[model samples]
Target chain A: MNNLAVDLPGLQLKNPIMPASGCFGFGREYSEFYDLSKLGAIMMKAATGSERFGNATPRVAETASGMLNAIGLQNPGVESIIETEVSYLANYELPIIANIAGSSIEEYEKVAAAFNETDHVHALELNISCPNVKEGGIQFGTDPKMAANVTERVKKASNLPVYVKLSPNVSDIVAMATAVEAAGADGLSMINTLTGMQIHLPSKRPLLANQTGGLSGAAIKPVAIRMIYEVKQQVSIPIIGMGGITTSEDVLEFLLAGASAVAVGTANFQNPFICPELIDALPHTLKKYGFNTVQDAIGKGITV
Target chain B: MKKETMRIKSTKRIALDTVEMVLENNYMSQTAVPGQFLHLLVSGHTLRRPISIADVNKTEHTITILFKMLGSGTHDLASYQVGMTIDALGPSGNGFQLHNDNQSTILLIGGGIGVPPLYYLGKTLAQLDMHIISVLGFQTSKSVFYEEKFRALGETYIVTDDGSYGDQGFVTDVLHSVESFDRYYSCGPVPMLQAVTASLKDKPGYISLEERMGCGVGACFACVIPTDDAGGYKKICKDGPVFDAQEVSL
Candidate 1:
């Protein structure tokens, strides 16, 4: 058997296939389709400091090879997640990564501390980089200093391994990644959705209610690869590469580009069975590429 | 919902832009309810298009779905013919709540492509020996379909905006002419739903909303609608494509 196991910071995954946060909702939704325990890890949806209703109608619009979303961290609060979502997710014997977002550093600390008390949660993914929200999201991610500050605060508040999910909407993605790593982030999630907008030609107005949304899917795959490649070179911390990964080949590409693990985003919308499909196909794909272990393939495409 | 590989038995253009597809899937035909929709995986399309179950014939083991060629996905769906196998995940969403013993009249109001799901609903209600009155609206006479099928089931009314078919106005216009109904079921664009909800404020009614979705299974919060609930929002894919008209804020 090919070794698909990956030890990402504090947590060890059966394989490197995990669904991106906001794509997988507590793993129960997809559990109806297949066994959730088969997955390497379940990345819970973004849980804010308080319950958020999210953005208005027309939150998503399709673009060529991709889609845009302005969901704005629509989730039950951290307390609710700990009380409800966490207990529900505990039924599955899989590593659960609590993805938390906040409007301020204190909120981030509070959520991280709360999640730290939870037993089922294996790690915390600090979402300092969601572009859809108005108050707290992408602001911290774009700037290295603010990103470092939030990362430092959240890392201090929690005993669990914290992974900073970086934004691709910045001028220097490497700087942001490095900042988070320096701020004591145990790991890094390279490339959140790119900021984009679509206009309705007939109405002469923006398609999304938020006017702007984060672009994700096949269209942004190349961008994700570039960012992961850059960040992996700059920082020693492990990276979870995700953007528009769909096929097993895409997973191999991200792995080669130095993603210790890969998260499937918009592809989940296209196919709900994607995580398992990718997992099943990974062995064959790696064999075809003449690789013996998943670790051997990691950073193989990079010169460093 | 089960993911079934269904073979298309036939495809016919019922209207100018509308096409009726019959698939030989016994599983879906048996499990499908009135308000539930199927998520079809079209070739070359990234996201599956959520198409409502228009009619299901258990004896024939066939499921009929009506789709309008609005975009590339539907345009590609139009090219599919008999013998082609299509991947479909369905019988999803909470369907309309049917009152079996309620002797009061039930109003089924639909607009455009929204009119198809009502046909199956009307059929189900008819089987229960309930009174079903359907008010269907279309943009023009060319867009009108399933009128005969609905008419054969129960008291059916059709209206066209261009006045080429039945009544010369919206479905609500015909609804206004009707004296009363015990309950109302609606599926249409936002404007029509708003008008119908306003007109039937005092009555108990249900409305099925259509939104551009990500995952048709409620994981992605793409197809969420604001509701008069604690969560403040409900997923149109899961919590409902069909919701109590009064419960959801239009």
Candidate 2:
């Protein structure tokens, strides 16, 4: 009953449980199970200007507690997303955050400028963390300068809130977080998939065609929480946190780490009921901890 | 699995591997056709595992699933009880098409785990009045399966790489003696599939491929197959897990 509303800087959500890009697929298939309108919002898969074939075979390599994926950011292009996925989800009663990544700065700005007025999209998640692709994806996240430049251009070009999604496969995440924030990023979605791998061993070869992939699941929770906590100390903008979050307690950990909102990424692959369970678990857990709202949990245990 | 088309039914555990628990369920003993599959919701696993219909029985739910314990979800699924109930969505997918009424005899070859779909195929061929010859291949005798059941269907042969069970060599070696069949169908590992395609390049055949799929529908394009065209890519789930050998590159 308490206010679940979250101020995502330039955007507002009734709640903070949006689907991470890639896992939810613009929210249609999952809708077959339950009404998607009940959730906060849907983040579209990463898109570029042209259709990409993605990586080679065996994109997913399952590890003991997590999964590694080298999806190569294979998308149907920005125009296609606008026509197919965005058009459909925009009318679903929630803000659609169009996630985009490109090989260049111009490509980022181009997508931002166009989607700024397209459909019901209220925000743009500039993805600079996808490691599987060849172009401007990981390059932007690895360097603070490129990350800031991309953020600045997208921010200037976009009328909608620009949320820069950061990669965890870096030496210092706070550097990337601070650079993007200073470059006018309105919000931050921390921790895209961590680069990892698995092999058949017997085959004397790598498990995935790409050899390595981004790892996401319950195993990465500890690392994700630590990074979110570190970034929370440096950036004032809201931090979107996700890593192996299969239960509500996981959501609380992100909040306590100073995440303004939390996202359910790899867990969706584990179970479709994760979102509803999270929504219900949050209130009960909040009350259990003697808090009335999730905001009460943010930074509660963080030193900063 | 209804009274009209089905008669025999039973659920049995045939093998337990480090990777998965292979559970077999039987359905539609009378009317169950070849190239068809069933759905099984192994409890503890979030969604149902759509396994190829290994074999059939009319009186009970007929199917078999070899589940690999890759993560917590599938790992939990490996522990499904023998009698526990679970949700399912099947007999889905466009299974391999088998028409014995055709003029020429048919050749069915399968390797590794790809033999699941061939089980029903063999049974259906037995029901028809045609010369059905089969080559069931595996890595070794321990993992080798369905040779006896296949023998019950028609002229069956076996080839194992380890030479533990039958002929020492690949299934392609057994395929060498096949004079001619009007059609051929197979499912197996990628290398085995490539070998099949290469060996039968002069002949016509249909193949079923396995890829890491996101949405089992065309929407995600996660299961795309690279084609001869520079700009063309076919979706395995939608375009097919089954495709004309001539159409697929490998």
Q: Give the per-residue Cα lDDT of candidate 2 at A266.
A: 68
Model 2 Cα displacement at A300 (Å)?
A: 3.0
Q: Give me candidate 2's TM-score against the actual structure.
A: 0.85
Off by over 4 Å in 2: B1-51, B56-58, B66-94, B98-105, B124-131, B162-165, B201-204, B212-223, B229-231, B235-239
Per-residue accuracy of model 2 over A4-40 as CA lDDT, tens digit each = 6777765567787877888777787677657788777
User: What pairs collide in candidate 1?
Assistant: none
TM-score of B-chain for each predicted structure, in order? 0.96, 0.80
For residues B142-240, could you state the per-residue lDDT of candidate 2 as single tens digits?
776667778777788888888988899998888878777777888888888898889888878888877765444344445678887665677675567
TM-scores for candidates 1 onward, in order? 0.97, 0.85
